[model samples]
Target: MPSSPARPLHLAGTSPVHALPPEVKIVAAFVAVFAIVATPREAIWAFAAYLAILVVVWRIAGISARRLAPRMLIELPFVVLAVLLPFAEGGERVTVWGLSLSVPGLLAAWNILVKGTLGVLVSLTLAATTPVRALPGGLSRLHLPGIVVTVITLMLRYVDLLVAELDRMRIARIARGDDPRALHQIGAAARGVGGVFLRSYERGERVHLAMLSRGFTGTVPLATAPARPRDWTLALLPAGGAVAVAVAAWWV
Candidate 1:
C-alpha cells in the first residue's frame, strides 16, 4: 500500500501556481499530457520543446528537478522496454554492432519513450503543485464519475492507517526472530501480506459501520470552490503553450 502523510499536498507559500484554482490546473495538466502523447515519435525536437515548457512550470511552481529526479526514476522499467523495441519489433533490418535491428521498431520505441516521459513529467508537475485533496474535487467538478472520485478519496484517507498497521506487523515478526531476508522465509512474508489484507478488510468494515452510525453519506465534501478568472488565465498559459508546441511540431 502507498503511504500517505498527515499533511495535504498544499505547501506553505503564496506561489502563483498554488494560487490557481485546482480545476484549471487539472485541465491544463490534461491538455499538456494529451499534447505530449499526440506528438510524433520521430519529433525529437518537439519533445525537447515540451520539456522546456515543463521546466518553466517547475520553476514557477518552486519545484526543483533534484526533487523530481528520484520520482522520475520509477519510469525506468518502461524506458528499458522502449529501448528494446528496436530489436523486438519486426521490420526492415539494418546491421548495427553485428546485430540486425528493425528501423520501424526502433522508431516505435522512440515514440513510447518520448511520450511516456513527457506524460509522467506533466503529471508529476501537477501532483507536486496541487494538493491531493483538491485533485478529487477538481476531477468531480470536471464531470468525472462520482464513484471514481469517491473511491480515490477513500483510498487516500485509509492508506496511511494500513501502512502503520503493516509496520507494526513487521516489527512483531522481527521481534519473534523471523528473518524475512532468508530464502525460506518467503512463505512467512506471504502470510504477513495476507494478514495485512485481512486486518485492512476488518478495519474497513468497522469504519463503514461507524460512518453508518454517524449518518455518513457516500460523498466526501470538498472545500474547493469555483475557478476564478485569474485561475483560468494561469491554467490557460500551460495549455496554450502545449498547443503552440504541437502546432510547431506539426507544421514547422
Candidate 2:
C-alpha cells in the first residue's frame, strides 16, 4: 500500500471547523486578519477581543494551546526584531528601569508584534482545519487564475518527492563515509544541491511531456462542493465580530 500524502500543519479531526468548506474558511481567515491589521495599535482591548474570538474558534476546533504554542515559535525572528526596536529606534525617549526606550518605537513594535502574531495565528487556524488537498479547490472557488492554481497543486503534490530524493542522496553519501554537515564538506553539499536541482528540472520536463500526451490542459481539475449559506454565516461570524471591534477601537 502507498503511504498517505503529507498534509502540512493540518490536524485531523471531526470538529465543526474541519467540517466547514475550505473556501468559507479561507475567506473568514482573510477577513479576520484584515480587521486585525486595520485596527489601531493603541486599542489594546480590541486585540484582546480578537484573541478571545480566536479562543472560541479554537474551542470549537478542538485545538489546544499546547499544540499551537510550539508552532508559534516560527515567528521568533520577528519577535527579536520587535524587541530591538524599542532601544534602537530614535524619537521621544522614556526611561524604563534606567534604560532609555523610544515611545513611538514602542508603539511601532507593539503594532508589529500584535498584528503579526494575530495574522500568523489566523493562518495556522485555517491550515489546522483545512486539508492540503482541499486548497486547490478553495483557490478555484475564489476564482484564482487557472495557471496559478495548477502550479500550486503540482508543487504541493511533488515537493515531497524532491525531499525524499534528497534524503536518499544523503543516505548514499553517509554510506560512503561522507558527512554532509562538516564544514570541509560544504563544497560537496553545494554540488549535491546542484545535482538535485538538475534532476528536478529533468523530472519536470518528463512530467510535462507525459501530461501533454494525456491531453492535459494548463489547469488542474479541482472539483469541490460549494459552501452552503449556513457554512458561510458560521465561518464569518467571528470575522464580523473582529470588524465590529476594529470599528469600535477608534472610539474606545
Candidate 3:
C-alpha cells in the first residue's frame, strides 16, 4: 500500500552540491559515468580513482554510503546477471579453493558490476542534490528538444495525481470486501489498471483543453532564470575531476 504522496528522489540538503545548477549536475553526472565506462575494465586502478572522485562528491553533497545503498537496488538484476557470467562463460579457467571459474568471464562480470554500480551511484548523487521540479528547466537550458522536456515535465507533474487516484480506487475496492490478492481478483487488478489509464487519458484531454483556452503554444516557457557564469564555473569541478581521472587512468 502506498502510504504517502509521491515525491521526487531528492534528499534535502544545503551543501554546495545542492546549490549547483541542475544542468551542470546532469552533465557532470553523465561525464563521470562516461569516464567510468570508457576506462578499460582491466585497469582496476583506474576504477579506484573514479570511485575516489565519487566519494569526494558524496562528501561534498553530505550523502552517506548507507543512504545510497538501498536506492542502488535498481542495479540488482544486472548484478545477478553478472554473477552468473563466471559460471556460464567458457575459456581459460582459474581455480579458487576447489571451484574453477572462467578468467574472461570473471573479468567481464567484474566490469559489468563495477561500471553499473558506479553509474547508479553517480545518478543517485545527482538526484539527491537536484530537486525534481528543476529538472525540466535544466533540460531546456541544456538545449534539449522542447517536446521531450514538455512531455517529461508533464509526466512528472501528473504522476502524483495518478498515484493518488489509484489509491482511492483501491480503497474503494477493499471497502467493498474485494480481495485483490485472490485468483479471481487478478482480472479486477488488470481492469483497475486499464481504468486508471482511461481516466488519466481523459484528465489529460481536459488539461489540454484548458491550456488551449489559455493560449498555450507548442511549448510552455520555464520561469527559472538561466545559469550564470559563476554557476557554470562551479559546475565544472565535478566534470574536470572526472576528465582528469580518465586521463590519468588511461595513462597508467
TM-score of each: 0.87, 0.89, 0.87
Query: Model 1, residue 17: what's the lDDT?
Result: 88
Q: Against the true structure, whose TM-score is highest?
A: 2
lDDT of 1 by residue, 145-220 (tens): 8778777877877877777787887889899998878989888888988988887788778977897799867665
Give the Cα error of residue 114 in candidate 3, in Å.
0.9
Question: Native-vs-model 1 lDDT?
Answer: 0.80
Candidate 2 regions exceeding 4 Å error are 1-8, 170-185
lDDT, candidate 3, at 198: 94
Q: How close is candidate 1 to the true structure, as a TM-score?
A: 0.87
Q: What lDDT score goes with residue 118 in model 3? A: 86
lDDT of 3: 0.83
Tens digits of per-residue lDDT for model 2 on 1-252?
Answer: 111344257888999999999999999999999999999999999999999999999999999878778789889999999999999999999999999999998999999999999999999999888988888889888898988987788787788888888889889989999987799998887898899999888988898889999998877666678999999999999999999999999877
TM-score of model number 3: 0.87
Candidate 1 regions off by >4 Å?
1-12, 95-99
